[model samples]
Target chain A: MSILDLGKACTFSQMQLEITYKGEPAPAAKVWRRVKWQKEKVDEFKTDEEGRVELPEIMERSVMQLLPSEFVVSQAIVVTYMDEEYKIWVNSKRSPEKNSELDGSDIHLKCELTDERRLVSDYESDFLTSCEII
Target chain B: MTALDPLNAAELADDIYQVEDEFTREIFYEKYKDRFELGKDSGLSDTGIKGKTGGILLKYPHMMAVMIEGKKKTSFDGQAVFAVKGTAGLMDALTDLNAGIKNARTGGKVHQGFLDVFDSYAGKLPTLSSNIHTIHCVGHSLGGALATLTADWLKSTSGKEVKLYTFGSPRVGLEHYASKAQRSIGAGNIYRVYHKTDPVPMVPTWPFFHIPDGGEGDFLLPSGLHLKPWEFHSMKRYIKSSKGDGSQSLEWSTLRSRRPQDFLDSSVEAWLKSNSIVSFTLNSARLLSAAILWVVKKLTNLLGISVVIAGSTTFTLLDRLAMLMSKGLELAKDVSIWVTRLIKRMAQMLGIVVREGAEMTMRFIRQVFIQAHHAVSELVRQAGRTLH
Candidate 1:
């Protein structure tokens, strides 16, 4: 599973990550959860020196959550086809944000590591606003 | 097609005159000179490529990217072909084999590399037409892979027959894509060239050639055929060479090469007949250090039990732990010494590797941007995704 079950779903807990022999952290590791996360309803910040999105809010966010720059669209992530590995993409959708004249459907991503060490655009879905009141 | 274009084996045999006199390797360096430097956004790098005078881009990667300048000269009939300049690395070196030259990723990057191989300027392909004419694609090493990708792209997009010419290319397809690619660019259409001793076109697994254990149809598994962005990314630098039109001065011809087999015929032959020691080794000190770390971690989690002594002589049941504690400390110190030394060495290596890798990566990313930009610019001229 992309996110490991640390048995802390919806509750407060600290989690450790499973590392592969290759020395990279699993895509989704279980870390501290349910801590008093302070997420601002509005987020506008740049990545810190570490290239991690140090959100003012308690919750950490992925790069996809940021503004759309050519940078995000130009990265790579590996996925296996049949058994052989071929790289598809994690780049900008080929279609430009122009009038409906072009192919209008260039949906591919670079799927790679960017200079920031963040996985670029490969956003599963664009933003959909949500809210909860206490 | 020109009088020189339609080269039958016999006709091709005659034209095998010395091309070395006209085209030297210098054009390869001259055309993509800017690639020797890096982009402002990418920061700087030291690629350590050859013939480099003092310049901004240093390190291996900056050497990877030379600026790509493209110019097209038509056939006598005015068909447009493009030439660019860039450098090649592992990916290009690997995919320049007969088994390696297929798939969009392998092809895409290799094509870019081919363009970058020499200061390119060559015959053009006719503008988009339904007519079945062939696009002649060619390169060496990574450039060869790029040649194959260019042909594949042209075949898929241009609705033209693709005549590919490659030298020492790597395995382009996993077991999956090879068959179909082989068929599309028939033996007649595709001429994969290789000289005797070039180990480069054969190493590295990026141009994945073998099928998993008992996986599938050829060494290429079906999954490998999916030309995804990652695949192209795997060999992007090689693709940089596709921006080729070798010089009015072409590169040193492979035909001029004295095949490696001829140079070391007997020893190589004997080894092929009998030596089979494909092995890798581990460092003993490193292994021992790892064991020490594992043991220390376990001990750190255990609770320490202490007992107060009522008299001059203190007798405790769990006091045996004293010996264990001392031993663990000694091991920990040893491990620390080794670890610190190892870390320093690793840091030195990483610094050099990452610095160069970053430079190559930066140049590579720029080319991807440029290529994607080209595709975007051409979006205006693109018709719907309908096949001709």
Candidate 2:
């Protein structure tokens, strides 16, 4: 197989997610990873008392046939807690190849208190989505 | 973050370094008596009771302060801060030169000289037993080092929040001491201000380190300006640099973020090498010419030539040699200026890299390293040729 074919083979990696509010662990927050364009939910998880969640292994797949030849499938993890939502994007091409498990030390979701407590507004969601990918 | 006021801290630090004669002390008290109640001065001796090594105490309604004095003479302070010998009589000087940490009564290891100085005055300090909201420790140079130890001691013993402000402090202790002190005093309470070119803050050269807890306020000279290292270390310069604004300069709460310990560690060696090269290049030619003239005069007198002939011959030979030496000195000066310009260019290039947001890229870093190596090597080669 060519190097591109080898790279396209199914590979699994576990992502450990942590949620913190002002440097303290935030527990029981709702989290889910979804495809950006399709709005299709891939998985859902919740943080434990220590504000940690270990997602099941994720598979890397090439979506060349579903979209354009250069298009790649990516995932965005959305976390909602206490009137705030944090979005973390994961690029499949940049995922670690050597390690089967990735500790989400850098994947910490910082939750800030909103000035007004209410449902997540569409404007806020769009703003967060359009902001920096991480 | 710190309960201790920055203006109060700066005033205390500036006051401690002044000449501590009775008249000066009275003047200092007069200036701040409305805000602070001056306490007894602690002197340092082998017994911790009879010398000029300890600091004075200033008590406010909510806070108690320990202000340690720097060396009495500016020249003495300069010498003591840079001396590499570990056996120096000055407690802070010895601490800077000493390599390792020693056990403290409070359960962690600390710099031995610092602990010794603190021990000498720990009993006499009234704040040790008080219910003060904060204990402020302020000093400059050697006194700055002592202030750090005092803050650590008070934090561990009294459990009171300790605020430390040091001006151009030398390295105080090892990594363990720094970590422990950070924990005890809370990182936000330590404010260390050093001018960009100050040499005092660069030693007891590596392995020894200072991680300022609050954050380091580095006062850089405005672009294209240079101050002699001594001038950078001066309390007057530090005061002027602050422009009487007592608050910490920037709001970066994290300690050692911009200039990490490793960056400082490496800079110490670079600073020393540059200083030695500059001093030797500037002085060696003049010294050599003076020596040659002295030898010629001695030889003429020893040969018992007639006074007139001796004087005339010596003048003729010395004049020719002096002319040659002047050319050499001029060449050395030119080389020195070129090296300085090269360094300035390197700094400007690095500044550009930082401004361009390429500082973290491996390619940019490698390019910088390569350029720096070439410049340093060229400087070394020039110095070598001059010496030859």
Tens-place lDDT digits, model 2, residues B1-388: 2333333444455554222221122333434333433344312111111113321211111111233222333221211110001111342233222233456655545555556655655566543223234556667665677677767776777665666767767667654566677777776666787654444554443224574522343322321154233345545455545443443433323223434222232343244234233322212322222233232233333443221222233332213322333333334553333323333333443343244322223334334434433333333233222210
lDDT per residue, candidate 1, B107-136, as tens digits?
A: 322222233322122122224333324445
Measured with C-alpha atoms, the lDDT of residue B23 in candidate 1 is 16
Clashes of each: 97, 0
Query: CA lDDT of each candidate?
Result: 0.27, 0.41
Q: Which candidate number maximizes lDDT? A: 2
How well does candidate 1 score on lDDT at residue A87?
A: 28
TM-score of chain B in each prediction: 0.32, 0.50
Which fraction of the native contacts appears in each prediction? 0.00, 0.00
| Off by more than 4 A, model 1 | A1-134, B1-86, B89-132, B210-388
